[model samples]
Target: MIAAVSGGSKDPQAGGGDGREPITAAAVAAQVGGVLVGDGSIEVRGIAPLDRAGPNELSFLSHLRYGQWFATSRAGVVLISPELAELAGTPSTRIVVAKPVDAMVALLARFHRKEPRAQGVHSSAVIANDVRLGEGVTIDPFVVIGEGVVIGDGSWISAHAMIGAGSVLGRDVRVHSTAVVYPFTELGDRVTLHAGARVGREGFGFVPQANGVVRIPHAGRCILEHDVEVGANSCIDRGSVDDTIIGAGTKIDNLVQIAHNVRVGRGCFLASQAGVAGSTRIGDGVQIGGQVGIGGHVTIGAKANLAGGAGVIGNVPAGETWSGYPARAHRDHLRASAAIARLAKIVRPLEQLVSKPFSSSDGESRANSRADSRADSAPDESGT
Candidate 1:
């Protein structure tokens, strides 16, 4: 047991500094200084969590709560904090460090290196007159840039992407393959549009008229602030009148739909398949889980957490956690669910009490019928 081990025993080794090379425990220690308690020559190929790590994977014991699972891990090497190293019982080669989590992050990046794209316009790319491409902007093959589009410096527009007229993309923006940006849209710096994402589509708004249902004209533009990332196939609609604004530092996962006139605050995290209806307002730092749906005209306060699969029809206050259909507070939903479960036990006894009288009457009727049949069979006693 490592319970009594001192800090003096920490064997700091350099971690994997060379990019894309399958390094051993010695290399890991060489890159990031940490104490090596086991075989430094063990070769590690990948990084993973403690529960899912294989024999060739490197894992980390970051939180003390996960120490229980560490005893049964099968990783080839593990990074652990000095204080918890003695308590951990994994058979894997242990690297006792000052911060296991930070070391893991550095090692994870080393394992996954990015492929650099060429910084220039492709030969087959089409550009309209008056389209402004800043210095070092890379346009991939078959990209269509519409008239009056302005792309900032160091931006990369991938293959087959369409930037509509009057759209402005800020510095260092990345529009992935097959993404579409409609007319009059504005994208801020360092924004990422993943594969097949759509921006500035017309909102679903109609007015009932005497002749027929008239489609509301979407006149306003869609705007995304700096450091925002939209996942694959996600869509953001243009506002009916006012601009649709997605605040800075927000991440929207795949298949998300943000309707027209929606205003999302900064640092919000919206998960995959989550949708916000038109004119809804989401506050800062809110966390919306996967498959959550917020109704039109609803306002979600700051720091509110909507659990996965929640359906919200009303407003949510700040810092509240909501769940379930027609979403309510998570704690209340749990309590109500528990109460409903208890009702099953309570209803069974009442049903038995209500049915007891009829059961007794049925038993009496059967007994009388048997007696009558016996009397009828005894006619020989009467000497007929």
Candidate 2:
């Protein structure tokens, strides 16, 4: 029942100039243990979204909100959750699995193969005499290594990356292109600093003097524990007195800002555009949604979840969910939102009643006019 969905010649073996191997649906089923609902012999060359998948591409449907895409998608082959396979009654091949997104990720690793980089220092890299580079370190073009810096073995410093003086990076670390590592910063093994990530920058700390604000010197370092991954364009500031620490296995999303003296615990996931102000302590396994702003000196307990755009001004208890601006408990937020919605209905009628003016020829107005005339005829401040 499998059919080609796109307006292209079926070429499952097709690939770009790189060495990405094509895989058949039978192989994919064997790899991810998905139940094939159609022909298993069809070959899939690449992976993409449902709308953008070509004839030889494998697509996925995970979120129900994207069902419109599924209803109209022309993907040649698709992966669906086992529970939703009946909803996808298309002519294309379907692989039913428990998690469609996870399967698609696996297919991505297969199709978009990483290019092998050579292990050596590029000629354009500037290395100081006191710099210690371990075996198998790959320094790309124009990389600047300062004095007394130690880069561990099997690490890759990409093009234009600057490792400042007295910084230490552990084994298998990857500092991507244009990433800046400030002095005295410490990164553990397998840490990844993605493109344009600024580590150990000066924190935002100032004192109000008689004349103006005086800037405090950022003296302490920033420590990213083992297996940490900082996304592109994120900034981790150095502490004013104590170290700003990112615990092991934490993955930060793009455009995040971790301020001075903030301690983020292990395995925490911070979504894109999230910010933690200075001196905040986030417990382990906390999940922070996109664009969430955490105030300074707040402590979030372990496994707490902060929803998107939440402004957390105080401590959050462990295993609780917080939402809304100036975040509160999840149930409280829900009740408050419901109350506001109900009040909106009640307020609309009152607003209309207040806006309407009194009738021009009303009986009440006539009575008031007669009373004013009587008062004018009867009374005066002085005897006439």
Model 2 has how many clashing residue pairs? 0
TM-score of 2: 0.82
Question: What tens-digit string does per-residue lDDT give for candidate 1 at 1-384?
Answer: 012211222112322222345788988887879988889998887777888777767889877899877989888888988888787476558888999889988877766534457767877898998999898888888999999999999898988999999999999999999999999899999999999999998999999999999999999889999999999999999999988999999999999999999999999999999999999999999999999999999999999999999999999999999999889999998999899899989898999888776677888999999999999888685697
Residue by residue across 1-384, what tens digits does model 2's lDDT show? Answer: 112222223344554212445788888887888998888888777777777667677888877887878887867678898777878435368888999888877767666645456678878889999999898888888999999999999898988999999999999999999999999899999999999999999999999999999999999989999999999999999999999999999999999999999999999999999999999999999999999999999999999999999999999999999999879998999999999999999998999998987786776889899999998899576876
TM-score per prediction, in order, is 0.79, 0.82
Q: Please list all clashing residue pairs in model 2, or write none if there are none.
A: none
Q: State each candidate's clash count.
A: 18, 0
lDDT against the true structure, per candidate, is 0.89, 0.88
Error of 2 at 2 (Å): 47
